[model samples]
Target chain A: MHISEGVLSGPVLVSGMILAAAGTTVGLKRLDYDKVPRAGILSAAFFVASLIHVPVGPSSVHLILNGIVGLLLGWGAFPALLVALILQALFFQFGGLTTLGVNTVIMAAPAIICYSLFGRAVHGATRKAFAAAFACGFLAVFFSALLAALSLIGTEEKFFKVSVLLLTAHLPVMIIEGIVTAFCVAFLKKVQPGMFARPGMTDPVRGEKGGGK
Target chain B: MTIMTRRMNRPKFRVARMRRVGPVGFVLLLSASLVLISGVPAALAHRVNVFAWVQGKRVHVQAAFSGGKKVRNGTVRVYDSKGALVTEGTTNVKGEFSFGLRHKEPLRVVVLAGAGHRGEWTLSREELSEEPETPASHSPGGASTDTSPVPGKSSPEAVLSREELRLAVEKALDRKLKPFYTLLADSLNRRPSVPEILGGIGYIIGLVGLATYLRYRKEGKEARPE
Candidate 1:
């Protein structure tokens, strides 16, 4: 979810930008040369996923898909998500330029967290991988929604009620993304086992030059 | 025998990789279904939309998410053209807000829905004025003559009557065409088209390609020295 311009305090905005800038630097430094294509493709997927709205009751919520990106790209999710968000802001105005840093941190930080918590498990036994994938998807949305609500705390009154509502609004989305990610992980496991290999691991033919996780 | 077994597994691996294409196909299928489901006439994403118009001495505003859901109890602030805060209030349960026009100049109305959703609308000076142009002869007497129109019944009273009639007509017309206006706004907020999605993807690919090329060149330079 995007925090529109003028909704955040000056301190919040500045801090968000600083955190985002630091995250992007680390992400770029860790970005494997070979995985650039994967990062780009996932960035595009993240961009388009926002347009897919799944109707819940009266209103509809779109897919963020940041969980899958983070699981696959690790720290690369930062740069990938940032690029996608900037394009979305430019093309569709989903989020304005002024709030871009805050929006990027809101969506991308959870992805990085999911990667740390569930990334390796996604490459384990079939059942364990499925469980981890589901958790990754669910937790990613859960945390992002929480961070979004937190961003509004400084600007609005009744912070708890608004935060709860924001989190509840995304409950269905969590389920949908969990199922989607589980299926994607299962498929990738069967087709491209190399994708699950640790970053910098050397293949007999490709050596250590191969890209990210 | 081991070589033959490895050869056999290679084909199987290739086949499995080919089937990996299934995930890409699944994503496309899911996107297609989403497009079909959300293609309904008056649905949009979560972004807020606001619209306002001058009706009589008050400005009427409606604020809602792009999905047509009302933004109830949200704060609505009004500012004059000179950037001075004119008035501030909250929307009713119906996502509708109205405030008396304090100044004849243009006005900006901003709706701040909690959780960082916001919508805004601006009304030009012409839209707020009852008459488009001033009467050339009455320029000097315009200010003092507004309230004492009974003394000069012919000029000021006629203008007042015309203003009243125009407001009545505009109100009726707004009510009659309310559905059309809502529909137009809903369509404007519809999900991005397939081409737009493709364009975004293209940009991402191009950006990644550039990054990859730069990385490759840097690595090449290092390897040449080695």
Candidate 2:
């Protein structure tokens, strides 16, 4: 879901940069040294994930995997995605270098939103956790599609039409992401329950089975 | 049995080592290997490319996604230097559109593939010169027919011969150079190659190292004050 170069206006691009900077600040503040390696791995995953295309929808549709990144990192999704998007723009012109801010916001905002919405529910091995993971995966892309369309507001396109078109085109991607996110969460919960950040100082290994509120 | 007892005596070291091989590192290694095995750099997705060049009186445009998928029925709008719509049409099944221009005056061609996927190329006035780079002057008489002329055609032999030779050279050059231009345009918006993919991952790792270094430096400075 990369928006190409020279499409957006000056104001939209500037505002996007400002918001992205603010988000990254918060993310970096919360992200401790212990978490930097995790962020890096997730960022690398994001860079590689966009290369795999599903070949569905009006245009090219690919797996973003931002939902999983968000579920793991929350606000940390901002800086993580920023790194990946920068590399994508530099190496592969999927998005413009100037529009990096806007593109980062488009991908990261939904991820942060999804994490806030479904991050807690999917913190365990419960079936409910898997269900929330699916929804998180599905909704993250849905919100990202909406944001991408919204970024075109200052341009020549009609907002309503573009939003509807983008949403419909990503319909299959939504389902696919949902399943992928669920699978990752289930696997992580079984293997490393400590991956998901808990609110209190709960033992990550034992908390997964009995920490459900 | 001695080694087993030694391992049992070093639970602290084992726990410390576990911290090093965290779940994130495991996932990274697993995913990196998966990518290496899949060889996904061959076919990238979504990135759109628009290439326009001048040929005879018409400026032709080709619009396609990075993975060689043509933008079928994509809306193509051509605007002149003054930002006025000069020619507008939909790309054909081949992702091609051409419009005759009365005057060069520089033109911008924008292609909307669909759903906010847009690509554009500007055609400079100099490119649309009177003398087209392609074989614009070639007659319908096929290349084979050039050598064996009609027995009774009412044309001068010397003038016809010079003209025929020029046309033949133009045709050959155009065929050879056209692919070069297409290659150039494709690179302007290309899919990720194997080297690029590997390099990008390497860059991410470098960034990670940089962040950790900065972090340690900051902590070290604070500890020195204490």
Best-matching candidate per lDDT? 2
Per-residue lDDT of model 1, residues B62-136, tens digit only: 887765667788899998878888899998887888877666788888988767878788888778776333344
- Residue A98 alpha-carbon offset, candidate 1, angstroms: 1.4
**Candidate 2 local lDDT, A1-213, one digit each (tens):** 787777788898999899999999988887777778878988988898887666654366777889988888877889999999999988888888888889999999999888888877886557999999999989999999999999997784698998988888788778878987887787666556668754333224345435532
- DockQ of every candidate structure: 0.48, 0.38
The collision pairs in model 2 are: none
Task: For model 2 chain A, give the 10-residue run with minimal summed lDDT.
Answer: A198-207
Q: Write the per-residue lDDT of candidate 2 for residues B161-188, one digit (tens) a residue.
A: 7566876775676677788877776666
Q: Please, what are the lDDT tens digits per residue for candidate 1 over residues A9-95? A: 899899889888889998888776777777887787788778766665434567888888888788888999999998887776677
Q: Which ranges in model 2 have alpha carbons more than 4 Å from their true place?
A: A199-213, B1-43, B81-84, B124-126, B130-189
- Cα-based RMSD of the predictions, in order? 5.8, 7.0
TM-score of each: 0.80, 0.79
Worst 10 residues of 1 chain A by lDDT: A200-209
Model 2 per-residue lDDT at B126: 77
In candidate 2, how many Å is residue A199 off? 6.1
